[model samples]
Target: MSEKQAKKERTRKRLTQEEKAKIKQVEETHRLEARALRENWLNLDNAALIYPAIGSTEWNSVFRLSAIISEKVNCDLLEQALRDTLKRYPFFNVSLCDGLFWHYFQTLSTAPKVELETNYPCRPFTFNRKNQIFRVLYLDNKISFETFHSLTDGGGAMRFFNTLLARYFELTGVKYKNLGDFDLNVRDLPVEEESEDAFHRFANNGKCKPRKETTAYAIKGALENPNILNVVLGSVNIDALKECAKTYGATVNEFLSAVYLSVMIAEKHHSNTKNRHPVKLSVPVSLRRFYPTKTMRNFSQYLNYEVPTDRENASFSELIEIIKAQSKNINIDYFQQMFNANIRSERNFFVRILPLAVKDPILKFVYNRVGERLFTSTLSNLGICKLPAELDDKILNYHFILGATKLNRINLTAVTFKDKCCLTFSTRLSERRVIREFFKMLTSFNLNVEIISNV
Candidate 1:
């Protein structure tokens, strides 16, 4: 090789080693506490006791970053700044291991071995060659910021994006005024207090076995020309939606729930069932509301509401009233029961000691069979997103994605953008047609709706 080529190769090797050393330093500084480990185990294993089951195929979180820099952007400087920022926040650098039995922290040398992509349609939990649980992908300006959901949830990945963007600006000769204030305290959040009354009520109520499947009608349709569609979200003035709810004595959630369920019932013709079984709607209630905790790991609960099929034939006004009544009954007491039941199951020493590999398959089977029988679909309303008023003049829009649980056959994710609310419905490939038809009916009601898809 030429003298210049040999010198370039030597420089490259030195940089690689330096990067590895940096990663190791960060990992060594943030050792996991015993309480944190126990909490992590409970979240990974016990939470599967309720809701939909999670397995190796659906257990991991994914992160991806794509940048659209100005034409004058220096790629090398931008990359260096990102590396420095990641070295400061190493939690994003680790992954789970031993079939979710432990978290195998990654060193700089080990990080490069993790896979940047996966073949699964839904993000599955898996360990990388480095024995880490998460992976990151870096792309150029070819992809849009909107494409991030193909990997991880909004909550898990957004902070990393903000950090990357801030660093990029610094690399391009721009001074970041608030860089010192960007520190995040993931560990300082308060622990949730358990309610004894709630636990007692739950124990007395007995365990709820999966309900038998009802005879509700299922809707079907086909997209004439399916493609990944752009979503142009417009705010619905929260006051307007709230006023609509107040007129019918309903809360904002109940009002939206009624509208969504009405669309489903109209499309499915659920009223025709011989036994008049109710159409169920699954709502994900954030545990943060009932419990005062902010652990970044999985911390959410769900409640199911079965809307009477007869409401499909009622006037819209009447349906909204019924939904309001149902929602008002949901309170701290209800969540307490859920928490107590979950803890009761996890407290079983024998079950707690069972290896995750053995427990996972059995849990998966029961969850898929039992969960589907209880609910028709899921609704996750993340409410208003908390972002800075100004993000380099690019306003952050709404966030939504499909749930990855094994029994989560369909999910409707809603978030407020500016003043309007944007809702996205995600279903199995088999049920995509049903979702499309529901959106079509929503548009026909004069509701400004848009469709976004990965097709």
Candidate 2:
């Protein structure tokens, strides 16, 4: 009787095991197929490819803050907080994988490689160490949050920073009630889609004539400690600035670009170079305008605006007109061509698998040379931030630091926060008089402006 009962029970358990195994196998098959499709689509768009040559592209963003707080914020706490936060919000927790022929592939076990070297050209892309590519560095007076650009733009970063800081204060026992109100629940945030429409389009109609002559300027100064002066200039009402742009038939971006070009031209003239070649400034346009996708990967593209160097007598009004004309000419077809061309260039299998050992050196050489000759400076304008209007109460100010690109010389980043636009200029040049003069001129126009210098 005992033997018969035991055999019956064993058979029942065996059937249950078989059913579970079948279900598990089906789920695995679905996941593998989904991953393959993602890889293939990324390959077609050329969005999944990584530039092995660039050091900054590999490492996550790094921040160095002044050490003032008495309590120490350790990595363990940061890691635990991040894990809990990610569990609540899965989108920020995802990473990319390399597949053969851009099809379904196996997940790699190791963390996506993040190259961190002091000499690397670009600013560190933030990596999520706990979740593949996202990472946060907390130094005694400095905190840097770096992420894969595909996850979020500056606006997204700002939101993350605010939340992280609130969490830090709560952990440190700071008497901040707002910290409790902060929603660390990732479930509340909307998941971003990876779509073609997420990028800004350009005109691509203008002629690309060869420059008459190219000049190189070697940046001089300490790469680390360039005198960093942060000036809090007077605020400009967002509405007034918009109206000003309308009056000039230019968007807020075009107007800011013109202001930057004017400053650069003034500096070039001060150098007294006889060659009157046009000065080119690279303007990084947020792709969010053209496409609706907001996932934080390198979704931004750039356009170049050439300002006549010989315009010593050109009034600010005239310069605005030139910028308006150039900016208006940018449209969707122009960007599609660029998007298509970049995809073709990376189609070579060798380019995708090139060993970093060989690629990095070649990239360094090419980047250094191009940095000296191609563009005078980079002008990045992160348009007016549209945050939940309620944040206007406690949020004091917002600012952005320019990334350390291939060129260690100089770069300008402008972000409009609240009602004011903050323009930050980073350079290795010893003479910051040009930047000062630029601010002074703005003041002369009765645009309440302030200057902060690292010099």
RMSD of 2: 8.6
What C-alpha lDDT do the candidate models reach, one value each? Answer: 0.49, 0.52
Runs in model 2 deviating more than 4 A are 1-52, 56-85, 88-185, 189-240, 243-247, 274-277, 309-313, 369-372, 451-455
**On a 0 to 100 scale, what is the lDDT of residue 210 in model 1?**
41
Report how far off residue 79 is in candidate 2 (Å).
Answer: 7.2
* Model 2: per-residue Cα lDDT over 126-221, one tens digit each: 332233444555544334456544445554555565555444544544444343344433334445343232332222334333333364332334
Model 1, 1-455: lDDT tens digits are: 99999998888677877787887777765555433533342223234233222444434222222333334344465456546544544444443434453222333322322122223223444444343343333333211122112122343344455555565555555654445455332222223322112222234444433434453333333322121222222234566666767777777787777776776676466334444446677787765556543333334556776677656577777777776677778786766666656666566687667776666666667665664556667676777644333334333344455434334345566776566566765544344544665565545545555444544
TM value for model 1: 0.65
Top candidate when judged by lDDT against the true structure:
2
TM values, all candidates: 0.65, 0.64
